[model samples]
Target chain A: MNRNRSVFLLSALVFGFAFLYVPIISMIVFSFNESKLVTVWGGFSVKWYGELFHNRRMLEAAWLSVRIAAVSATCAVIIGTMAGFALARFGHFRTRTLFSGMVTAPLVMPEVITGLSLLLLFVALAPLPFIPDTRGFSTITIAHITLTMSYVAVIVQSRLSSMDDSLEEAALDLGARPWKVFMVITLPIIAPAMISGWLLAFTLSLDDLVIASFTAGPSTNTLPMMIFSTVRRGITPEINALATIMVGIVTIFVITAGVLMARQERRRQLETRGAGR
Target chain B: MANPSYVTLGQRILAGLDKALTTVMASPPYRWSQGILRRAGVTGRTLVIAVPWVWLLIFFLIPFIIVFKISFAETRWLGSPPYAPIWEWVEGHALHVKITFANYLFLLSDSLYVQAFLSSLKVASVSTILCLLLGYPMAYGIARADPSWRNTLLLLVILPFWTSFLLRVYAWMGLLNNHGVINQFLMWTGIIDEPIVMLQTDFAMYIGIVYSYLPFMILPLYSNLEKHDPTLLEAAVDLGCRPFRAFLSITLPLSKPGIIAGSMLVFIPAVGEFVIPRLLGGTDSLMIGRVLWDEYFLNRNWPVASAVAIALLLLLVIPIVIFQRYQLQEASGEQQR
Candidate 1:
C-alpha cells in the first residue's frame, strides 16, 4: 500500500479505537464526579465507590452473578469440551448434521428468543415431578450454559482441529488405550483453549441481563438485572462506579495474561532458534 | 516416553493408573459390558457425541419447540404457565390437540408487531453495513501492522468486548444524553446553539449497536485479512496495479468469508436487540425484542410474547443457516490447509 493509504488506514484505526474507548473512559471519569448530575463536572470524589461497596443489594447481586458465571462456565467447559472432541474426532456420526445444527444455532440465536424459549420450557415442564416449578438459580444457569457452551465448543473445536495428532497416535502405539491417550495427550494440549473458553463463558454469563431476567425467579436478581433496573430509574453515579471496577478488573487481568503469554511465546521461539544452531 | 532409566513420580503414577485401568477393563464383568456395548455399536465415540448432543437437544432445541407450542396455545392468566396447555388429556384418554392461531392472528391484524419486525430488520441491516464500513479499515490496519504491534492492536479491539455489554451501552448514555458529554462539548464549542437531542433517538440506537458489535465485526475480518499472503499484494504491485484497485480486486474479494461471518455476527443479534433500543431509542422506536418484552412483562400476554419470539426465530433461520454453513466450511478449509 502507498504511504498515503497507510496513513489513512492508521487514522481510521485511531478513530475506531477512540470511538470504542471514549464512552468507557467517560464512564470512568464520571464515576469520580461528585455532582449528582452526570453532565456537570463537579470536583472529583471517591464517594460513589464508597457507596457502591456499602450498597448491600448491589453487592449481593454481584456475588450472585459471579456464582452463576462460575458454575455455568465450569459446566459449559465440560460439556463443550466433549462436544468439540466429538466434532473433531468422531468423523460424521448418524445425527452429526442435527447435532452440529443444535450446537451452532445457539451461537447466533438472539438473546430474547433464547430467553423467552427457555422461560417457556421451564413453565411448560413445571408440572413434571423432576422439573422445578419456580424459575431460579438453576434455570438461569442452564439458560446461560446453552448460550455459552456454543462459544466454548467453537473455541475448543478450533484448537483441536488445528492440533497435531502424532503425540496421540504415538501414545496409542505404545500400548496406551484410546481413552488414556486422550487423557494424557489431548487434554493437556487443549487445556489452554479450555481455560480461555471458560473465561469467555464466565464473562458472557456474568454480562447477560436479558436471559437471566427472563429465567430468574423474583428473588434471583443478578448484577446486570440490578444495573438495568437502576438504569431505568436514571443515570446514577453508583452504576458508573460499578462499571469502572468491572472494566478495571477485566483490563488488568487481560493485559497481565497477554504479557505473560507473549513472554512465554518469545522464550519458546528463542529456545527453538537456539537449538536450531 | 516414560523414561525407564529415570522414572519420575508423575510418570510412575500415570503408569500405575494406566495399568490399573487396563486391568479393570480386562476384568470379566467389564469385558462383558464392553462386548455388549460394542456389539450394539455403542463405543466411546458415540458416548462423546451423546452428552453435549443430548444437552443441546433438551435445553436449546427443545426450548424452541416449547416456544412454538406455547405460541399456539391460548393465554390463561391464572396459572404457573400463564398460557393454556396446547394439548390436554380429557375423559377416555384420547389425544386432544387444541392449536389456536389466535396469537399469530393478533400479531398479523395489529400493525404494531409487523412494524416492529420491519423496523428491527431495517435497523439491523443498516447497523451491519455501518459496522462493515467503519470496521474494515481498522481491521486492515491492524492486520498489516508490524508483527510486534499486531497483538496489542487486536487486544485493543477485543478489550471492550470483554467488558459488560450493558455497561458499554450505559456508558454511551453518558456520552449522548441531552446534557451528556457530546452535547455539552458541542454547545461549548459553539457548534450548535442548542443541545441536539442525541439520546433517545434512532441515531443513538445505531451508535449503541455499532459500538457494541464493532469488535465482533473487526475480529473476524482482521483474522481473515491477517492470513492473506503479503506476497500476493507485492505481485499485484509489481504487475502495475493501482494500490486501491489492488485492494479491491485482491484483498476485498479474498475476504468475502470474513465479511459474511462478521456481518452475520452483528446482524443476527441486532434484529432482536432490546436493551439498546429501549435504553437508547425513544419510546417511539419499535423493535421486535422490545415489543416482545413489553408483551410478556407489561401486557402479561405470554402467548403473544411467545408468538413474537417464534416470528423472530423464523426471521433468523435463514441467516443462522448461512452462518452455520460458513463455519463448517471454514473448519473444513482450515483442516485442508
Candidate 2:
C-alpha cells in the first residue's frame, strides 16, 4: 500500500498490458490498410474485409469450426458434469484414483502427443462397423470432446466441492429421489459453472490448431488450420481482416461473460451483508 | 370381479404385470434382481460413474495404449496399416511376432533426436523462468489492487487468451519480420540504419512462447497470491521487518504451490510445442515437437514418430506424477481441515 510500491506495481501492470495488447491492436489497425504490404500504412480502406467476405474457403472453414466447437462444447459439458458429480459426491469408488487421473491428464498432455495418439486410435478402430472410415468433422469432434471434457470436469469439480451440500441433502431427506434432487436443486446451482465450462470448451476448440491439423482430413479445414497454412506462405491482408473479426467476436463474448460474473458476485456479497445485518 | 369390471384397462395391465413380477421375484434365480431393485440408488450412481469412465477409458486411455503398442511395432512399407502387426497368424501357422526396440534405440543412437530433446528442454525451461519473472509482478499487482478494480484487471489478463492463438502468433510475425512494424519504427526514428534480421530467430521463438503462455502463468499465481491474509503481512511489518523482507519470507514462500503449478502447466506443453518454434524459429531451431511432426508427416515413418511421442510421454510422466501427488495431498489436507 506504500506510494512507491503502488507506483511500481502500476508501471508493471502498464507494461504487461502493453506487451499483451500492442501486437493485437497493430494487427487490427493493419487490417484496414489500403496498401498490400502489412507494415506500410496506406490510408484506411475496407477492401481486405471485402476480400475476406469473398473468400469461400475461409468462410466454410470458419463455419465448420463454429459447428464443431458448438457440438463438442455441449457434449463435453454433459459428460464433464457427470464426471464432476461423481468426483464430488461419490466418496470413494473402486476406480476413483484412476478416474481422477484420467480426467485431469489432458490438461497437461502436449497437443502433438494427444493428436497423434487419437489419430492412431481412430485408424486402429476404422475397421469396426461403428467407427467412421475417415477423419473429418466427427473425428475432430470426438478428439475435441476428449480434450475439453477434462477442463470442464476440473472446473465443475471445484465448483461443486466449494458449494454447500445442505440443499441437496435436504431435498433427498424430504423424500425426493436422488435423480430428482440433482435435477431440481443441484443442476440450477451448478448452472453457472456449466456455462463457464461450455464457454471454455468452445473457445478451446475454436483456438486449437495442432490437434485439428493432425485429426482433420484433407477436405476438412478448420479456421486455425487455414490461417496457419496461409501464414506459412506469407502474411496477407485478408488474414488480418479475418483475425480482426475474430478478435471482435471473442472480445464481445468475454466482456459479456465478465459483466455477468461480476454482477453475480456483487449480488451475492450484498445478500450476505444483508443477512449479517 | 365387480371391481375388475370397474377398473380401467391400464390398471388391469399394471396389476397383472405387478403380480407376474412378484412371482418372478419369489424364484431363487431372481434374488439378485430383487437385491438390485432394493439398491436402486447404488445402481443410479454406478450408471453415472460408468458412462464417463467408459468414455475416457476408450477415448483417452486406449489411445495411449495404441500409441505405445505402435511404437514397438516395425514400420512396413507395403501394408494397408503401415505398421506391421505385433502378432500375426498365417494360414494354419503362427509366425513369431517381431517387436522392435530399434526405433527407440535409433532415437538414442542418433544425436539429432537427442539434441532436439535437450534443446527443447532448454528452451522450455528458459521460457518458463522468463514467464515467471514477468508474470509474478503482474499477478502481485492484480492481487494487491483495490477490490473494485481486481475483476476488471483479471478480465483484461484473460481477454487476449480468448482470441485465436494462431492469430496472436501471426501478429508477432507482422511485428518481427524484417519489413515489419518494429523495424519500420526503428528506421523512422533514426535508431538504426537498416532493419535487423529478427524473424525466424531464437529471440522470436522466445517472444512467441512467452506471449502465448503468460496468462497460464499469471492466473495460477494470482489465485494463490489473492488468498493470502493481509494480516500476516501487517504482522510482519509490526515486527519491524522490511517490506521486501516480508515479501520474500512470507509471500513468496506461501505462493510456492502456485509457482510450481503454473510453471508445470507452462513447461510441459512448451517442451512439445510445435507451432511456436515451427512458425518463429529458424532452421537451426530443432525442437522435439517439430521433429515428431517431420518424422510422421514428412518422412512417413509412423513407428519412429510413435517412438518419439512415447519417449516424450515417458519424459513428461515424472513431472505429471509428482504434480498429481501434490494435488492429491492438497485435496486430502483440505478435507482433513
Candidate 3:
C-alpha cells in the first residue's frame, strides 16, 4: 500500500509540474529560434532579443505599465491597509457587512463587468469638474486600484485577525497614544503582510489586460495591451522574446522572496529555541 | 539668563508662539475639542474606516449604480455620450423621465444572448470541474510532501501566475495551432498521418482555462489539506477502513470548505472570461463577456451593453451572496475555534 501511494504521488508531481511548465519552457526555447516560423527550430540566435529592444512602441508601453503599476500599488496599499485595519479591529460596526462585501466583491468579480462599469463611470463623470474627460493613465490607475485593493485588504485583514491583540493593548497600557501604539507595535508586526500585499497589487496591475484595455485611451496602451494586439495579428518571435524575459524576471523575484522567507523562518525558529533555553 | 541676551529674533518669536499654543491647549474650550476628537475615534479607527469607505462608495458602488441606470436608457448614434439621458428637464418646471425596458426585452427575446449566457455557464462549469480533478492530486501531493520541499513546490505553482497572463495564453497558441508544436510533435512520432486542428476550438478553450486557473484551485486545497490532522486518517485506518475509504470518509468531508471556495474562485471569473474565449475558442464560442465587449466596442451600443452587464450581475448575485456568507461563517468559526 505504501509503495503504491508513493508511486501515485511521484507520478502526480511529475505530470503536474510538466503540465504547468512544458508550454512555458517551449515558449522560452522558441524565443531563441532563428527561423521566422516559431514552430520550426533553426539554429539558436539572439536576434529576437535585439529586435525587442529596438521596438520603441513595446518599450514605451512597458515603461508606462511599470509606472502605472507602481503608483497604483502604493495607493492600493494605503487604502487597503486602512480598510483591513477597520475590518480587523473595529468589530461589528453599523456597516460591517456592507464594508466587507464591497471590499471582497472584486476578488471574484469578472474583469469584463468591472471594465465596462468603470468605463461607464468615467464617461459619466467627465462632465463634472475635477474629473478627467479622457480615459488615459489616471483612469487606468484608478481602475487598477479598485481591482487590486480588494486583494490587499484581504491579505492584511487575514494577517491582522490572526495576530494577538495583547501586544497592542500592552503598548496602550504603557501610556502610548493610539497612533503611536499602532505605528510602534502593530505596524512592525504586520509589515511583512503589507509588503506582500503591495507586491501582489503591483503584479496584478501589471498583468491586467481586459480592464486596462477599457480604461486606457488610444495613446495610453499598456504592455499587455500591446502584446494582445500583436498576438492577435499573428504569432511573432518578438513576443516570445518578451515572454521569456518576463518569465526570467518573475522567476528571479519569486525565488528571492521564497529564499528570504525561508531564511527568516529559520532565524525565528532559532531565536525561539534560544529564548526557551 | 545669559542665553536670553543671545537669543535671535526668530528664536524669541518661536518661543512666544510655543507658549501661546500651550496656553490655548490648556484652555477649557481646546480641551473640550480634544475630548470630542478622542470620543469620535478620529485618530485611527474612524479615519481608517472612512477613507476606504468613501473611496469604495465613490469608485466601486456608484459605478454599479451608474451601470444599472444606464441599462434603462436608450442607445443613440448622434450624441456625445452615445446614450439618451434617462431624465431630462422639460419646458417650465416640468420634469420628463424616459426609461425603457427594450434592452432587457431584447436580451430575453434574442436567441444569441440566451445562447451566449448558457454557453458561458457551461464552459465555466466544465473548466472548474477539470481544474478540481487535476488540482486535487497535486495539492494532496504537496501537502503530504516533506516540509523542507513543500514551500519550494508551492512557489513553483505560483511562479507561473506571476508571469504575464497574456503571454501565457499566447504561448498556448503557439503550441495548439494547426502548424504548432503539438501537431508537429505528433506528426514526427507517427501517431497520426496529418496534423489535427486544435486551436480555435472548445477543446483549446478548456485547456486554456484549466491551465490558467489550476493554481487557484490548488492553493486553497493545499492550505486546507496541510492543516488536516493525520491522526484522524490513522484512526480511520485502524478502524478497519481501507486507505481510499479513510480518505473518502475523513479527508474529503473535512476539506469541504476548501472545495467550495476553490470552485467558486475558479467558476466565477471563468464565466465572464473574455480573453480566453476570444483568443482560443472558435467563432461560434460566443461567451457573454465577448458579447458584451462586441456590443460596446464593435456595435457602439452602450445601453444594450450596460443591460447585458446588469443581467450578468443579477445572475451572479446569488453566488456572490452565498460566497460572502460562507466567508463570514468560516471567519466566525475560526474565531470560535
Candidate 4:
C-alpha cells in the first residue's frame, strides 16, 4: 500500500508539472513551425521569426511600450522610494496607518475601477491648461505610475525598515546634511530594492492591458492591446511568434537573476567563514 | 537631485507657505506622534507622503465619487452624466434631481444579473476549493522536504508568474482547444475516440481560474505548513489518533488563516474578473464582470455601467471590511507576542 501510494504521488507530481509546462513548450515549438497552423507541427524553421521582424505594427507597439515602461518605471521608482522611506523611517505619525492603507488600496482594487476612475479624473481635469487631456502617452504613463508606485513604495519601505536606523544617525553625527547623508548612505543601501521595484514597474507597464486600453488615446495603442485586438481578429503565426519571444526573454532574464542571487549568497558565506578563520 | 522644473505653480504655492503653519494649521493638523518624521529627512518624508496622497485623492478617490454621483443622477438621452446636480429654485425649492431606484431596480428585477452574480460566486468558490485541494498537498510536500530544497520548490512555483500572464492564458488557449495536445493525446491513447469540445465552456473557465490562482494558494499554504510543528502530528499519532483524523484536527485548524487568505485572494479577484470569462468561457456563462464590460463598451450604457460597478463595490466592501478586521486582530496579536 505504501509503495503504491508513493508511485501514485510521483505520477501526480509528473502530471502536474507536465500540465504546467506543456503549453509553454508547445508555444516555443510552434514558433519554429514553417506552416501557419499553430497545432500541426511542421519541420523546424526560423521563417516565422523573420516574419516577426518585418511586422511593422508589432515592432512599433513594442517600441512604444518600451518607452512608456521605461519612463513610468523611472518616475515610479523615485516617488515610490521617497514614499517608502517616509513611511518606514518616519514612525508614530497619527495618519501613518491611513497613509499606508491608501497607498495599498490600488494594489487590491479591481483594474476596471482603477481604469474607469482615472479616466473620469482625467476628463474632469482636462480643461486645465497644463494638464493637456490625460489620454495619450502621458496619461498612460501617469496611470502606470499611479499603480506601480504603490508596489515600489512597499518594497523600498520594507528594505528601509529592515536596515539599522543607526546608519543614518552615524552619518548625521559626522556633520552630513540630511539630503547628503541620504544620497551617500541610505540610497546606496536600498539601491537594489529600488532597481527591483523599477523592474517590477517596467514589467507591469508593459503587461498592462486593461488600464492602458481605457486610458490609451487613438494614437497610443500598447503591445498587449495590439495583441489582444489581433487575437480577436484571428489567431495567427505572428501571435505565436510574439508569445514565444516574450516567454523566452522573461525566462532568460529571471533565470539569470536567480543564478546571480545564488552566487552572491555563496560568496557571502565564503567571506563570513574567511573572516571567522 | 532637485529638478529645475520643480517650481510648478502648485509647488511654488506649497513651498511659499510657512512649514510650521502648514503642519499645525491644516484642516486635520499633521499629528507628529508617528516617530518616522523626526527620524527620516523631513523634506523627503513630506514630499513622499503629501504628493502620493494628493495624487490618490485626485485620480483614485475623485473618479469613484464621480461614478457614484452619475449612478444617482438621471442620465441625458445619450446616457451620460447629467448637466446639473442637485438644485433648488424660487418655485417652491424646485429640485432638478429626480432620484429614482430605477437602475438598482432594473438590476434586481433581471434574473440575469442575479444569476450572473451567483454564477460568479459559484465559480470563484469552486476555483478556490480546487486550488486548496491541489495546492495544500503540494505545499505540504515541499515544506516537509529537506530544508535545502524548499527555496528551489518555491522559486519554481513563482517562476511561471513572472512571464506575461496573458501569454500563459494564450498558452492555455492552445492547450485546451479541440485539436489541442491533451485531447489529442487522450484520443490517440484510446481514452476517448472522439475529440472533446473544451474551449468556450465552463470547464475551460474553471481550468483558467485554477491555473491563474494556483500560486496564491501554494504560497500561503507553504508558509503556514512550514510553521506548523511536525511534533504535533507525531503527538497525535502517539495519542492513538489516525493519520487522517490527526490531519483534520491539527493540520487543518492550524492552516485556517492561510486558507482564508488564499480563498479571499482568489475569490475577490475572480468575482470582478472580466478577462477569463470572456476569453475562456462561453457567451452563456453569465458572470457579472462580462456583463459590466458589455454594458460599458458594447451597450454604451455608462449610467447602467456605473450602477453595476457601484453594486459590485457594495458587494465587495463587506468582505474587505471583514478582511481588514481580521488583519488588525492578527497584527495586535503579533504585537502582544
Candidate 5:
C-alpha cells in the first residue's frame, strides 16, 4: 500500500510539474532559437532579445507601463493602508459591513464591468468641471489605483486583525502623541504587510491587460496592451524575450525579498532573546 | 523650583488641549456618521486608513453611477456615442427627461445574449467543479505528505503562475492547434491516424480554463485540508467506520468553506473570462464576456454594451451575495470561537 501510494504521488508530481513548466520552458527555449519556426530547434542565439531592444514602440509602451505601475502601486498602497486600518481598527462601526463590502468589490468584480463603468464615468463626467479629458494617463492611473487598492486593503487588513492591539495602546500610554505613537508603533509593525501589499499591487498593475485596454488612449498603450496587439497580429520572438525578462525580474525580486524577510525575522528573534536575558 | 512648576504647568496645558481635541473629534454626529476615526488624530495611521474612503468613493462608486446612466440611455445613430437626454429650451414645451429602457430591451429580446450568458454560466460552473475534484485530491495528497516535501509540492503547484498569463494561454494555442504537440505525440505513438480537431472546440476551452485556474483551487484546498485533525479520522476508525466513510463524513464537511471559496474564486473569473474563450473555444462558445467585448469595442454600441454589462452584474449578484454572506458568517464564527 505504501509503495503504491508513493508511486501514485511520484506520477502526480511529474505530471503536474510537466504541465506547469513545459510551456514556459518551450517559450524560453524558443526565444533563443535561431530558426523562425516556434517548435523546431536550431542553434541558439540572442537575436530575439536584441530585436526586442530595437523595437521603439515596445520600449515606449514598457516605459509607460512602468510609470503607471509605479504611480498606481504607490497610490494603492496609501489608500489600501488607510482602508485596512479603518477595517481593522474600527470594527465596531455600524457601517463596517458596508465599508468592508465596498473595499472587496473591485477584487472579484468582473474586469469588463469595471472597465465599462470607468469608461462611461470618464465620458459622462468629462463635461462637468475641471476634470478635463479623462482618456489619458490620469484616468489610467486612477483605474489602476482603484483596482489595486482592494488587494492592498485585504492583505493589510488581514495582517492587522491577526496582530495584537495592546502594542498600540502601550505606545499611547507611554506619553507619545497619537501621531507619534502610530508612526513609531503601528507603521513599523505593519510595514512588512504594507510592503507586500505594494508589491502585489505593482504586479497587478503590470499584469493588467483588460482594464488598461478599456481605459487607455492611443498615447498610453501599456506593455501588455502592446504585447497583446502584437500577438493579435501574429506570434513574434520579441514577446518571448519580453516574457522571459519579466519572469527573470519577478523571480529575482521574490527570492531577494524572501531572504531579506528571513534575515529580519532572525534578527528580531535574537534581539528579543538578548533583551530577555 | 520655578523650572519644575513651569514644566508641570506646560504639561497640564497640553493635556487640557488634548482632551478638548478628543471631545470634538469624537462628538456623536461625526462619530456616528464616520466613526471614531476623527478621534484618532490626523496621524499617518488616520490618513492611511481614511484616504481609501475618498479614493473608493471617487473612482469606484462614481464609475458605477456612469454605468447606471448609460444603461438607461438611447443609442446613437452610428453607435459611437451613448445618448444624453433631450430637453426643450422653451418653457411651454413638454420636457422629456424620462430615461429609456430600449438598451435593456435590446438585450432581453436577443437570443444571442441569452445564449452567451447561459454558456458562460455553464462553462464557469463545470470548470469550477472540475477544479474542485482535481484540486482536492492533490491537496489531500500534499497535506498528507511528509512535512519536508510539502513545501516543494506546494511550489510545484504555484510554479505555473510565475509565467505570464497571456503566454500560458498562447501556449495552449500552440498545443491545441491542428498540428500540435499532443496530436503529434498521439500519432507517433500510433494512438490515432489523423489530427484531432482540438482547437476551436469546447474541449480545448475547458482544458485551458481548468489548467489556468487549477492553482487557485489547490492553494485553498491545501490550506483547509492541512488543518484537519488526524485524530478525528482515527476516532472514526476507532468507532468502526471505514477510512473512506470517515473522509466523507468528517473531512469533507469540515473543508466546506475552502471548497466553496475555491469554487467562487475559480468560477467567478471563469465567467468573466474573455481570453480563453476567444482563443480556444469554437464560434458557438457564446460566452457573455466576449459578447460584451464585441458590443463595446467592435460594435461601439456603448448603451447596448452598458446594458449587457449591467445584465452580467445582475447575474453575478446571487453568487456575490452568497460569497459575502459566507465571509461575514465565517468572521463572526471566528470571533465566537
Candidate 6:
C-alpha cells in the first residue's frame, strides 16, 4: 500500500512537471532550427537570431517595452507599498473598505472589461483642460501601472503581515517617530518583498498584451503587440528565437532569487540553533 | 529658560524641528528642512493613502461607469467621440437626454451574443474543473515532498508565469499545429497514418488555458495542504481508520476553501480569456471576450462592445465578491493562528 501511494505521488509529479515544461523546452530547442518549418528537426543554427536583430520593428518594440516596464514597476512599487501599509496598519480607517476593494478587484477582473473601461476613461478625459490628448506612451504607462500595482500591493501586504510588528513598536518605544521608525526599521525588513514585488510588476507589464493593445496609440506598439501581429500571420523561426531570449532572462532572475532566499534561510537557521544552545 | 510659560507656537515648532534635525543631521538653522518636514507632518499618511485611492477611483472604478454609460449611447461615425452623447443642451434653454436600450436589447435578442455568453460560461467552468483535477494531485505531491525539495518544486511551478503570456500561447501554437511536433511524433510512431487535427480545435483551447492557468490552481492548493497537521492523520490511522477514509473525512473537507479559492482564481479570468481563444480556438469560437474584441475592432460597434463588457462584469460580480470574502477569511484565519 505504501509503495502504491508513493508511486502515485511520483507519477503525478512527473506528469505535472513534464506537462509544464515540455512545450517550453521544445520551443527552446527549435529556436536554433535552420529551416523555416518549426516542427521539423533541422540542422542547428543561430541564423534566426541574426535575423531577429535586423528586424527593426521587433527591436524598437522590445526597447519600448523594457523602458515602460522599468518606469511602471518603480512607480508601482512605491504606490503599492503605501497601499499595502495602509491595508495592513489602518484596517478600520474611513475608506478602508473601498480602498482595499479597489486594490484587490483588479486581480481577477477580466482583462477585456478593464481595458475597455480604461480606454473610455482616457477618451472622456481627453477633451478636458491640461490632459494629454494622445494615447501612446503616457496613456499606456498609466494603464500598465494601474493593472500591475495591485499585484505589488498584494505581495507587499502579505510580507508586511508576516513580519514581526515588535521591531517597529520597539523603535517607537525608544522615542522614534512613526514615520522615522517605518523608514529606519520596517523598510529594511520588507526590502526583499519590495524587490520581488518590483520584479513581478516588471514582468507582468512586459507580458501584458490586451490592456496595452487597448490603450496604445496607432503608431506605438509594445513587443507583445508586435508579436501578436506577426504571429497571427503564421509561426516562424524568428518568434522561437525571441521566445528563447525572453525565457532565458526570466530563468536567470528566478534562479538568482532562489539562491539568495536559500542562503538567507540557512543563515537564519544557524542563528536560531546558536541561540538555543 | 526664556520665560518658560511664554513660548509661542511658532517658536515651539522651531525648537522641535531644531532638535529633530540636530539628531538626524548636523545642520545649520533648522529653517531649511522645516518646509519639507512640516508638510510631511501635516499630511504624509493622508497623502500616501489618498494617492492610490484617487488613482484607483479615476483610472479603475470610473472607467466602469463610463463603460456602463456608453453602453446606452449610440455609435456615431461623424462625431468626435465615436459614441453619441447621452445628454446634450438643446436650443433656447431646453435640456435634451437621449438614452437607448437598443444595445442591451440587441445583445439579449441576438442568438450570437446570447450563445457567446453561454459558451464562455461553459468553457470557463469546464476549464476550472479540469485545472482543479490536474492541479490538486500536483499540489498534494509537492506538499508531501521532502522539505528541501519543496521550495524548488514550487519555484519551478511559478517560473513559467514570470515569462511572457503571449509567448506561452505561442508555444502551444508550435505544438498543436498540423505539422507540429506532437502530430509529427504520433505519425512517426504509427499512432495515426495522417497528422490528426489538433490546432484550432476545442481540445487545443482547453489545453492552452489549462496549461497556462494550472499554476494558479496548484499554488493555492499547495499553500492549503502544506499547513495540514500530520498528527490528525496519524491519530486516525492509529485508531484503525483507513487512510483513504481519513482523507475523505478530514483532508477533503478541510481543503474546501482552498478548492473554492483556486477555482475562482481560474474561473474568473478564464471566462474572458482573449488570447487563448483567439490564438488557439477555431474561427467559430464564441467567447464573449473575443466577441467584444471583434465588435470593437472589426465591426467598430463601440456601443455593443460596451454592452458586452457590462454584461460580462455583471456575470463576474458574484464570484468577485466571493473571492474577496474568501481572501478576508484567509487573512483573518492566518492572523488568529
User: How much of the true A–B contact set does each candidate keep?
Assistant: 0.83, 0.72, 0.67, 0.31, 0.40, 0.74
lDDT of 4 by residue, A1-277 (tens): 3355345545655565565677778878777888777777778888888888998998999999999999999999987887777767776676777777667666656677677667666766788799886378899998999999988987887677666778799988989767667755687668668877998898889988878877887678889888888765545677788888887888788778777667755755776676678
Higher-TM-score candidate of 1 and 5:
1
lDDT of 5 by residue, B176-227 (tens): 6676667878888999999999988999899899888889888878878998
lDDT of each: 0.90, 0.89, 0.89, 0.75, 0.78, 0.88
For candidate 3, lDDT tens digit of each residue in A28-72? 999999999989999999999999999999999999999999999
Across B213-259, the per-residue lDDT of candidate 1 in tens digits comes to: 99999998998999999899889999999988999999999999999
Q: Put down candidate 1 lDDT per residue, A3-28, tens digits, no spaces.
A: 99999999999999999999999999
- Candidate by candidate, in order, the iRMS in Å equals 2.4, 7.2, 6.4, 6.4, 6.1, 6.5
Can you list the residue pairs that collide in candidate 6?
none
DockQ-based CAPRI category assigned to the predicted complex of candidate 4:
acceptable
| Candidate 1 clashes between residue pairs 3 or more apart in a chain or in different chains | none
Model 6 chain B scores worst on lDDT over the 10 consecutive residues at B1-10
Local error of candidate 1 at A102, Å?
Answer: 1.1
- The stretch of ten residues in a row with the least summed lDDT in candidate 3 chain B is B1-10
Clashes of each: 0, 0, 0, 8, 2, 0
Of 1 and 2, the candidate ranking higher by DockQ: 1
What 10-residue stretch in candidate 3 chain A is worst by lDDT? A180-189
Docking class of 6: medium
- Tens digits of per-residue lDDT for model 3, B13-33: 545665676688689998898
Interface RMSD of 4: 6.4
Residue-level lDDT tens digits of model 2 in A189-273: 6878988999999999998998998888778899899899999987899999998999999899989988877776676677667
Q: What is the lDDT of residue B259 in candidate 1?
A: 99
Worst 10 residues of 5 chain A by lDDT: A1-10
In candidate 6, what are the lDDT values of residues B190-296, reduced to their tens digit?
99999888888899999999999999999989999999998998899889998878888998898888999999999999999999999999989899999999998
Sorted on lDDT, best first, the list reads: 1, 2, 3, 6, 5, 4
Worst 10 residues of 4 chain B by lDDT: B79-88
